[model samples]
Target chain A: MSNVIEVKNLTKSYKEIKALNDLSFEVTEGEILGLLGPNGSGKSTTINCILSLLKYDEGSITVFGKDMKPDSYDIKAKLGVVFQDVAVFDELTVYENIDYFCGLYIKDKATRKKYVEEAIDLVSLSEFKKFYPKKLSGGLLRRLNIACGIAHKPKLIFLDEPTVAVDPQSRNSILEGIMKLRDMGATIVYTTHYMEEVEMICDRVIIIDKGHVLASGTTDELKRLAKIDEKIIVEANSFDSKYIEEIKSFKAVHSADYKERVLTVSYKEGADNLVKIIEYLKKNHIKYSRVYSERPTLNDVFLELTGKELRD
Target chain B: MFVHNFKYSLKALFRNKTLIFWTLMFPIILGTFFKMAFSNVTSSEAFKAINFAVVEDDNFKNDEVFVTVIKELSDEDGDNRIFDTTYVENEDEAKELLVDGKIDGYLVMPDKKDDTPGVTFINNGINQTIIKNVVEEIALNEKIGNEIGETIVKDEMAKGNFNIDIDGIYEKVMEKMSDETNLLDKSANKLDYSMIEFYTLIAMTCIYGGMLSIASINNSLANISQKGKRVSVAPTRKLVTVLSSLLASYVIQLVGLALLFVYTIFALNIDYGDNIAKVILLGAVGSLAGLAMGLFVGTVFKAGENAKTGILIAITMFFCNFAGMFGITMKYITDTKMPWLTKINPVGLITDGLYALYYYNTTDRFSADIINLIILTLVLTAVSFFSIRRRRYDSI
Candidate 1:
């Protein structure tokens, strides 16, 4: 696939703190590239640098094969950005707001009307078209914000934590709308703190921390990097620490812990690992209600690569 | 792109109740207050014939010139009249009227050889002054014309032409007494000092254009507002957006100014000038200058939104106060003591332009003030644009 955005050696500093340090990444066309990072990890700064909204100390950013600059309207015309904040006019109705923003990119009246209506439908804000932003609920307001950004139907879009503080339903609808946008042949660069959102909607993910990208790959590929072959959970009426210790001695077991009425065993790598754990439990007569086995999720990969350190 | 930006900007600003209130409705409300407060003042200051009582005594009957002068001065006809004269039966009645404040003053005819007929007043004031001046001028005319008539009569008698009708001669003298000069020249001067208050109010209203320009700048620059970020990232050039938004501001301000002008000129009954077009032109330029000043403030300062708005209002009102919104003489003091401030101050410039239109006979001063305001507008607009040109925020 062709690359829509490329960044090389991006560095940004603010007074005494470094925001982005030699960060590099590329977003290929026709895919949702999730930029996953904890708070204050240069995700917003990176997106701002790529959008030419901020000047970096050292960087080269190109969008659609052109060096991105503040005056790069040609490149910006095909780009849409939905900031993390709910940026919209409170005085304008939903339709008027969408029309005003859509008019920014599409000048033709008829085409703009069609696109505005389509966007209103895409976000499912048809009923609230005539309502002012202040009168709408939080979820409806968020949908209106999205409609404003994507109404022009730009080829590349940047959604900076679009689902932050949103309810589950709205977040799901937003994710579905974003997927629909991608299916319509647009490249999306999504940023969020939610790891599941990245795993659910992102075709590829970049895990970053401390102004550095620790790893980047598809969800399954990134999970493999965690090196956790299986996670086995056993629900039991009673669990003994001796049993946990015994499970920990197994050659395939990486770690074992028992909490409440359940016991969990993480295996490093082994085929039939679940079977071995089940046979051992049956032989020890460790009564269990349910047992399940699963592979490591994308969050496990994130925690493994970025380290489970608290960031401010 | 410009049209789209301008249209949306107009819509947004119109919907902004705060802007609408301050720009359009507040000025009208203040004007109503000014009208109510100044109406009585104008009425009290209007020129009306003074009232006086004359003592009808033997000395007064002998003084034919005084009698005729009073007759002509207090005639029933509105024209060529200065006093509403009443002849009293005695000095007690005249004094009673004077003390009772029914008449402004009383006139007494000369009774003794050393006595001269003169005016008396209850107190020294504008009405008393008017009555005193008119009575004094009549006394002087009688004295001068009496001497001239005596000389003419003696010369005619010496030439043995004594059948010249001396009474007719005296009447002619009275007729030609004050014909060479008029007491009050009301032909050329049209300035009513009370109207300066309204002009200053209009001047203050014009400066309210700052609100619109500040809104424009705030809505177009990324660091100023969230809407600014969207505007910055739009496909349209930033310059186009800024200028179009400014044009929208100018239109809205001009409309507000026009409303103020119409209200003050017609509804409030204040005379701005006879040249309506020129007055409107000066006001338009003043609004532009005011808008530019606000844009300059918005672009040059990175203050918060409310802070910037407060600064704009405070600064404009400061200049307006100096331009005499509070007192008419303040403008004169500022003009004389700190003439450069008057030249540089936008509100002062607009107030002076309107003042010149009202008081000055020629358009020279008005044109100069207009030019200065236009230059100020251009300079401020240039500085504002220079400050905002391709500006990229370190963070937003």
Candidate 2:
């Protein structure tokens, strides 16, 4: 498969902070690559380096086999950028905004008109075409940002946290849009802090932290790499930390956490772990309100790989 | 791509309210100010204010002629206005008053030297040339009128045509000549009044153009503020962007100048002059100078709206002040010898061009005005070129 983007030994720094350290990545045509990282984990830095928006100390970045610069019109002509901040001309209405963005790419008025309408339809913004960006809700504005970015139907796209601060409904629609773009054969590199989004749509995921790639694979594959198998949580009025540790002595229980008058027991590759936890709770005479048992998820994988402590 | 960029500039020009106001309305307001201040100069009143002050000296042979001429020149009902008059003590006092804003000009006469009498006039005025004309005409009238009055008195004494009362005959002839003097001043001043206005209008136009240039370039540079971010991703080079943007603003400025001309010439019937072409040329040159100045400011510093607009106003005001916008700024200006700075100054050049075209004939100096415009345009272009080149959009 032909790779749509290629970055080799991409290293970038700002003063003393190393934003990207010898990063290497590629996205094949028609594939969706999710770049998952916590906040300030060099995700944006990587994307910016790839886009040539920021100069890098040491690296080579190519899109469609050509170098990029401010005057790289040939490559930039096919480029589409949708900043997370929702950038659109305030003076222009929704339709004009899309038309103007599209106009930048496609000058033919009729062709631009068709593409703008298609973009509006793609974002489900037909009803709000006449409204200004300020008049639209956050969801509609986000959609408008998407429409403006993708109206020219670029072959390669970098959707940087497109669903940040969006409502659940808008999130679903954005996810659906990503899927539709992927099906339409655009190679997309999506970065987001939301691991659930990575699992939902990404064909492949690379998780990075502190300017270094930690783990990269499919969701299930990543889950397998993490040692913890299943996590069990029990909300109780009061639980002794020592009793939770005693539950950890169970052969299947890999680890246990007790805090805020509740107990969470993580088991290693086991099915009857929740039942065992409940019995242990009852025998201990701990009054529990509710219980949940779930297999290892991408979020669990994320925390396990990047430590459970809060990052600055 | 260039065409779209041009269209984008047009869209920006039309839609951006602040840009529109600065480019179009600002100049109109400025022009209205010029029109109000210069309204008197353009009307019939320009003739009446063309006065000369005569200082009475001790060694004068014709003291009676000086006082009688003054009295005759003054219209009885109309403040005895004869191109307006002022009587002062001596040359120093007359000129001091003229300089001190008490009179337009003062005429000095040396004691009658057999055939070589000297008259010196100091001008404190709007129409110095007109004041000079009044002084010269009065001097000529008194010299020849006195000669003829004395001749007629002697003829009446020798011919015995009447009772030979020499003083009475002199008075009658003087009265007759005084009536003629009044007629001559009235006709001459009325006929030549527009010349003064023509020069004033040219100066005012230059002021307007200079000020508007600053505003136009400022607004043009400001137009690029938002697009500064887009430059990184845009297809066109920064050179193209700046050039195209400046060119677009140049067009808007031309429109502003046209509006001024229309308001003055067509709407208000203020005759700009016979040389309409020169006026147009001056407007174009002045606008270019303003545009270049704006570019200089834009490229000099990373400016916001207030500072950007401020620099524009300041530069235009600076240049316009030198352009003699009100005839007051350059009143005491004694640098007429080196007309290069005044002539090479874009405002000065345009004002000079307009003045020549309106009042005088199309001389070589008018053509040299083109050279002045060329130099100014080149200077501004170099400044703008360097500015745009040095203007880095790194991480902006």
Candidate 3:
């Protein structure tokens, strides 16, 4: 697929501090590219620079093979951006807000109306169409914000932390809607600190830290970058400290940690690691309430790369 | 795009309760209060004829011109009477009237031919001032009349016409002095001191249009509001958006001004003079200046909306006070003492324009005020445009 956006050697600074340091990335057409990073790690800055909403200190950005500029009306007409902050007008109703923003790009009344209604339906905000922003709940307001941003139905959409501070149901709905947008032949650039969200909807992921791109790949490929293949957790009321040392002695066990009545062991390369731990627990007469094993997650990859959790 | 933005901008500005209160309700309420405060002041404080006694001594009786002037001024049946003169037989009786407070002052004839007439009063006041002014004017006119009579007699003798008519020369001198010394020219428009308050109120109302423009402009600048950020990202040109929003604000401001005019003219029965069209024109230009001020405050300052609003209020009230909204005396003081302040102030310009329209026979002053207001509006708009046209910012 051709690239919808390209940024080479991108750099941005806030006085003495750099916000984006040699940040480089490409968003392929018709795919969801996740920009995963902690707070203040240049995720929003990168998106702003790409959309020409900000002036970077160095490097260049191009959208649809043309240089992005503040007056690039043609490129801007075909692009949609949902900023991290809710940007809908409080004085307008949900429907009016959507219609107003959509009218910015779509001049036809009939088409704008149809698109506004479709957007409301996509974000499940049809029931609250007549409600003002001040009357809507936080999650519903977020949905309205999304609907307003995407009502124009642009070929490329930028969703910057669209699901921040939302309930599970709203987050799920937002993720599903983004997936639908990707399925409808639009290139999507999604930014969030939620690793699970990146894992769920992102076709390709780029992990960023302190304004640097640490790693980039599919979810599974990124996960492989972790030092461990499998992780096991055992919950018990009582556990001897010696068992952690014993677990670490296992050939496949990369490390073991025990705290707060739970013992976790990570395997470097192993199958049936949970079974092995369960058999060992039984032979040692150690009573465990539950034992489980799972594949390494993107958080593990981030921790391996930056020595910190993705949320930190 | 302009229409779309304009339509929504109107809706947004109209729905803003804060903007509505400051731009419409606040000025109207303040005007109502001003009306109530100044309703009866003009009538109660109007000028009344002063009372005084004149001693009919030998010198007073011998001066026919002075006696005739006093009789004409003290004629109760005359329309131009300025004094309630009480004739006394001697100086003792006039002094008794002055001491008893029955008269503001008494006019005493000179005992010697070379001495001037004198006035006596128990207290200094408007009535005493009027009496003193009248006595001094009569003395000066007598001196001028004597001088003219001598000049005419000498000129006639030089022409060899020795039968000089002294009475005719005195009559001509009196006529000429009367014609030349009439300094007060009553205008066709009545002197309404209360109208100054109303004019300043109108000026206040016009400058209050700044609030509406500030709110509208705030919604158009990317660094000021979230909605502005959304607008900045749109494909439409920034000029169209800014101009359309300002036009909507201007229309609303004009409507508010029109309502004020209707209220003050019809309901309160206040007369805004005969030049209603010029008054409206001044209000329109003044409102434009107000909008320009708002645009300047909104874009030039990096402060928040509330801070900018505080600054606008400070500016509007400052100009209004200087324009005599608080009191007519302030307007006079500013106009006489600090005319440059009034020249630069939008509210002062509007108030002075309205004052000129109501009080003057010509439109020269009013036209100059209008021109100054338009120039001020253009300058503010140019500066604000320069500030607002910047598409990129160092920070949001």
* Candidate 3 lDDT over residue span B135-234, tens digit each: 7656666766677778888999999999989788878887776664431222212445567778878887787888888888888877788788888888
lDDT of 1 by residue, A138-224 (tens): 888889989999999999999988887789999899999999999999999999989889988999999888788889899888887
Q: Write the per-residue lDDT of candidate 3 for residues A19-63, one digit (tens) a residue.
A: 899998899999899998778888988887887778888998999
Per-model TM against the reference: 0.75, 0.69, 0.80
Mark the regions of model 3 whose C-alpha exceeds 4 Å error after superposition. Answer: A238-252, A258-261, A283-287, A307-312, B40-190
lDDT of 3 at A291: 93
Tell me the TM-score that candidate 1 gets on chain A alone: 0.94
Q: Which ten residues in a row have the lowest lDDT in candidate 2 chain A?
A: A82-91
Checking candidate 3 for backbone clashes, the offending pairs are: none
Model 1 spans with C-alpha error above 4 angstroms: A227-295, A307-309, B40-192
Number of the top-ranking candidate, with lDDT as the measure: 3
Ranking by DockQ: 3, 1, 2
Q: Estimate the TM-score for candidate 2.
A: 0.69
